[model samples]
Target: MGHRVLAVLLLVAGFVVLAPGTACACSCSDLKPADQMRLSAAVFTGTVVAARQVEGDPAGPTPPIVYTFRPDQVYKGEPVTEVRVASNAESPACGYRFSTGGRYLVFASAEKTGMLQPDPGVPLHTGLCMGNRQVALGTGPVRAGDPVLNGDPISAELVDALGAPKPPSAAPSAPATAPPTAAPASPAASTGGSAPTWIIVAGAVAGAAVVVAAWRLPARRRVRRD
Candidate 1:
């Protein structure tokens, strides 16, 4: 009986140690090309259908730029379950292509195009000019062929194409300062206009009188619990 109990406890301990290895913690850049193929449902190999520049919203920190990808020379490489756009080390304008790893939303785009335009729209497609259909990353719906304007388009895709870059432990900005606070209102302010000394004394006396009256009541007696 002792051995059986010990064995059960050992088994439980082993499972706890090994469980985390099986969990999905994949980041986009962490996955290799082979993994990308295995995981994605569809893939696209096309030039930037549309790219644009945008200002980072000061109200928002570091805004993201978006890109519109249209299928041009569509070769169905392993169904892309995920996508990433990598940025260039030399420049922030053009991004490389990247793929996703195990964790969702992590993307990398590794290849960079040096200022290339999308193939001119064929007669079958007619509407907004090729460059006009960009959307802000956090602003709108994401669907195939939707125009996207990345605030820092190249950087946006580059990070997506590559894995997320190492994060700096702290921002370069000066540390935040505590805002000035007003002094707490005095008792006079809290009581509305000026209150006379007699009124304050009377209030204190009345409160003490009530407390004394309640304490003296016969029901205040406690019954001993044996």
Candidate 2:
């Protein structure tokens, strides 16, 4: 009886040591608004353009949604005109769920990568457990129950720190052209550098009359002297 009890105890101890162990769950002590903003790699306010399932996405609790945003203000990091971020459709995967046409204050990291993601300048991936949160879209005070911001209104310093974002360039205007000039007048329309035939005829008649009068006067004088 004593030998059997010893064998049973030895078997239990060996099994406990050899079996696979469970990994610890992810945990974080929630951070204050300022600390979270400081720790994040990129922070901005933007409007969501669209949401769709990206190509070649990885397996998760739900099909991950890729959100495209047009940035309105940049608090830190690159001032991208457009940014793409991926998060699980369900919040469990730490994905930042985005609604189309909704604006948000996003605190996200671009360190996460995907299998087919293009260059980092194009878009970035954000997930749950990354400490990313949403603040009120406007410049007003942060509302109550905001994940990290709590109820603090936006700081004047933050407003001052916002980078000057270059707006989209307008299309070039078409060149203005002078209306086609009036066609030049023809030679006939001008005097054409020639006198009329009537003037030439009048000059010839006057010269013939003058010559006849001189010949007649000389003959009459000679006859009277003789």
Candidate 3:
């Protein structure tokens, strides 16, 4: 009875030590490419412009690693020129390490409230199990069943599932060119190149009155001489 009790105590101790590792171990289901695309909120091909590990409270959970991407093509969701994706900081948590300047095909999901979000406004999150893989920078045509180039079979599968991708919408078409405003007229041009009609009539009446006064003066002189 004493031996059995000691053995049971040792077994319990072993289980306690192993439990943490088992709980944190990363496991992923074998989902097909199409299924992976469907589950994702946003899918695109981009190059990692920057990457950083977020700092968190020491007593809290591990911080997330964030990658900033310049998207080359968008397969799903609103087209964006730049996107930020956050992931776990360690492999056990399924964090994907992306190198700066390396091109990749990313499958990301919207994480509204979670430890995976490194910042308040970050809209996307990705992991090793999210079907994110690095690809060559070649701009060649994508074909199904080919090796993982920029436009690989996986990308082809995404294209088939979500149709062709479009580039980021251009700068709102420069606000329609503003229709060429006409120049304002000068003060002289606005008056039609003429004086007022009332002023001209007043000048003519003054001249006629001066001539009548001169004629009356001459007649009065002739009458006085007679």
Alpha-carbon local distance difference test for all models: 0.32, 0.54, 0.68
Report the C-alpha lDDT of model 3 over 82-114, residue by residue, as the tens digit: 889888776666677888998887888773434
lDDT of 1 at 74: 22
Candidate number achieving the greatest TM-score relative to the actual structure: 3
* Best-first order by lDDT: 3, 2, 1
Please give the lDDT score for candidate 1.
0.32
TM-score of candidate 2 to 2 decimals: 0.46
Cα displacement (Å) at residue 119, model 3: 8.4
Per-residue CA lDDT of candidate 1, range 110-197, in tens?
Answer: 2221122232122111111111123323312223344334322323332233232222123257879999998998767877868967
1 or 3, greater by TM-score: 3
